[model samples]
Target: MNTFKTEIVKTKEQSKTLAIIVVVLFIIANLYIFLIEKENQNVYLKSISFVIYFLGLFFLFGQSFIKPKPIGFFEIADTSINLRLDESQDTLLFIELDNIILKYTGYGSWWTHSIYGNKNYLLIACKNGENYNLEILLRNRSMKNDFKAFLNTEALQEKFQLKKTKNTTCEF
Candidate 1:
């Protein structure tokens, strides 16, 4: 009955915060190299800090792909699932989806699985031409559980295999 909408203003705020942190890190690196390191100029520490500074830039680049928040609107009705994306002017409705897989994307995905947490992207991947296959970012733990429960149960779950194998059928 509820729809999860993309909070554009929240995204903007997060982006601004990330930009500020990155800028501050770059400034700190510069300050350490020029002002603080006037004594010994420890090359190893400087190199490490420089790497950290570059990592901040890399994070900025990767942030778009690993969204800071849910980027699409998701609705888990009694029988079907609907995905609405602001990025694409399209509404993808699924009465019976082929596969509802939880895929992990990122470096060290296994470590993500084993240690930190499940970096699972809720993938509503269907077969050809429908082309409405969507990857939804999951931000909250409760919502992720709710999504899994909804998809793994009777109505919508009947269409999916839920196995690790690939299923090519698309009936939505």
Candidate 2:
């Protein structure tokens, strides 16, 4: 009888924006140090700044090549999970809970997975030998706790294997 809904958060876009801001600031600082502050030059400090600036540039440009993930909604009910990733009609999907063989949720590794973020992906392996990957957005602590509790409930526990891992791996 429990139900859960999805929330959209633009984490990748936020990261890319942060990288761009950092790169711009680094560029300004490097220019000030190399061109304006030439009278009191510190080689080590200047070299470190240059290295950091390049790293920022690399991150900023690297992010540009990755296509952004589309916004989506996951409606999880007692019997099924409804997926509506895009607004288009072709993007609708419905997965029956009874058919699920395995469910993987990330609850490990601080650097690779966040306790609450857009990166919290749910992997469902069905009895019919189909695997589906969907990003779940748990906006707050209460929501996250509730979702985990639901998955670990007696009914679902008997129906499927609930796995906690450092990260969810899905091959499409």
Candidate 3:
């Protein structure tokens, strides 16, 4: 059995900058709607602006205050892999070795990189209709390499067959 600790990256300076921009937009939108548009009676425009600005403010608060925390444990045993990602749940994932159908470095597009930093990630998909699209963050490059190597080892290969192609459909 092999055990490893997972790391979670904190929001970067870009998030702070985005948050500031959102705040400024929120204030300007509110001032315009309440001061000038009050007589215009643009009900739809006012409601839409309020919803958009409120969502922006929520995003800003989450990015500025909520800190990311690493998972408690990441275990790779002979038959199963275990992960404790959610603090509220006792065990976030307990997947059988044979259940995993795909593993790849996912979300490499420019847009994904712009939002989630330019870091490598592991995407795991299970057979029981589970798609774990979120990146599995590791400590460093070396550890990530080790984990990748382990996944390609004869022991794991004998346990499950990997799919040759990945789904590339982009849903809007």
- Stretches of model 1 off by over 4 angstroms after superposition: 1-71, 87-96, 104-119, 125-129, 161-172
Tell me the whole-model lDDT of each prediction, alpha carbons only: 0.51, 0.56, 0.49
Ranking by TM-score: 2, 1, 3
- Assess candidate 3 and give its lDDT: 0.49
Model 3 residue 150 lDDT?
61
Instruction: Enumerate residue pairs that collide in model 3.
Output: none
* Model 1, residue 52: C-alpha shift (Å): 6.7
How should the candidates be ordered by lDDT, best one leading? 2, 1, 3
| Ten-residue region with minimum lDDT total, candidate 1 | 107-116
lDDT of 3 by residue, 49-120 (tens): 788678776764544343434444455544456655567322223443333443433322343322232233
Could you give candidate 2's per-residue lDDT for residues 106-171 as a string of tens digits? 322233244344255566656555566665555455666777666666656665455545445421
Model 3 segments more than 4 A misplaced: 8-68, 71-73, 88-118, 158-172
Per-candidate TM vs. native?
Answer: 0.44, 0.49, 0.39
Worst 10 residues of 3 by lDDT: 163-172
Model 3 C-alpha RMSD to native? 10.0
Q: Candidate 1 lDDT, tens digit per residue, 1-172? A: 6444322112323477767887788778777777884577788879977886788767655444443444556566665555656665444445435566655332122223212222334556554445344444444455555556666667556555443223312111
Which candidate comes out best when scored by lDDT?
2
Runs in model 2 deviating more than 4 A are: 8-70, 87-118, 159-172
- Residue 147, candidate 3: C-alpha displacement in angstroms: 0.9
